[model samples]
Target: MKYDALQRLLVEHLNSRPVPPHAAARLARVRAAALARHAQRQRQRVRLPEALGRWLTAHNAAARRSAWAMAMVTALSVGYLGWAEWRTPSEADVDIALLTSDLPVEAYLHPNFTRDL
Candidate 1:
């Protein structure tokens, strides 16, 4: 109840007093100066060396991440291909199979053994 009464009194006191015209002009000048300072601060921020440093830091992080991803993909592809190759039989194994077969030795020596000349 006391707070409400105080608030009502403050409202009545504020409503009774009229602001002078000079105060509005002074407020306008202060607002313009504040806006000008804010603009100047923004301009100075762009001109500072730390702005370039921040840009370079962000750019380098993205580049590093991209390079690392590409390297990992390449490594995994090469590793998978190497593993597949290891699973398959080699040229030496094919030669041994051919040499140990029960077919005639002359048949193995012919270049077109399966086809008629």
Candidate 2:
């Protein structure tokens, strides 16, 4: 493959090149910065609410897209909560409805119940 030949030439050139004295310090700084960024992102995730953080981490979010992703997560969570609130009856509602009445659950399961109604 063309990529295999290119990689071989690049490897030979790198092996034959002399290492610069300043390269170590530069590499160390770059490594430290990368590690610090990684740690900071971890801290940010920890500080976030657990569900949002889990969703983002599960998807392997990119560092540069985190801000937009966070906004999307929050909006989606809010919309979901709002929708769920409107779509389903709360426990209190069921309790209130049955507070003064009792019905046998088996009544609803009888095959002729609907036909008789």
Candidate 3:
């Protein structure tokens, strides 16, 4: 090839849009190895939070089960409270109690009933 053609080929290759396959492969390997080494070093220098995170993930199922159990207990407690409120004695219950007792209904129903007691 002519010297001018060789110079043009060198310039074009240098300004190429895509990388050569071998260079790309080598760069990928270097980057991957660097990242792997960083991760390994980070693991060796483990912090409390990282260790705790690992522990939590390892017991993920147990954590989920405990959370579900707590939720069920809370739901049951709320439901029981609602049921108790609904079952509370009303004015009718007082009237029924009065009727069942030996005392006269009118005396118990009188305005002075509380004051008399």
Best-fitting candidate, scored by TM-score: 2
Model 2 agreement with the true structure over 6-61: per-residue lDDT tens digits: 99999999989787869978999999999999999877745457777778677754
User: Residues 11-109, candidate 3, lDDT per residue (tens digit)?
Assistant: 999888788899999999999999999999977977999888988888879788998999999999999999998999898987788779888877876
- Candidate 3: minimum summed lDDT over ten consecutive residues — where? 102-111
Residue 66 miss distance in model 2 (angstroms): 26
Global CA lDDT computed for model 1:
0.88
Order of candidate numbers by TM-score, starting with the best: 2, 3, 1
Clashing pairs in 1: none
Residue 74 in candidate 2, Cα distance off native in Å:
26
Query: After superposition, which runs of candidate 3 have C-alpha atoms over 4 Å from their true positions?
Result: 1-59, 91-117
- Model 3 lDDT vs. the true structure? 0.90
When summed lDDT is taken over every stretch of 10 residues in candidate 1, the lowest stretch is: 43-52
TM-score of 2: 0.38
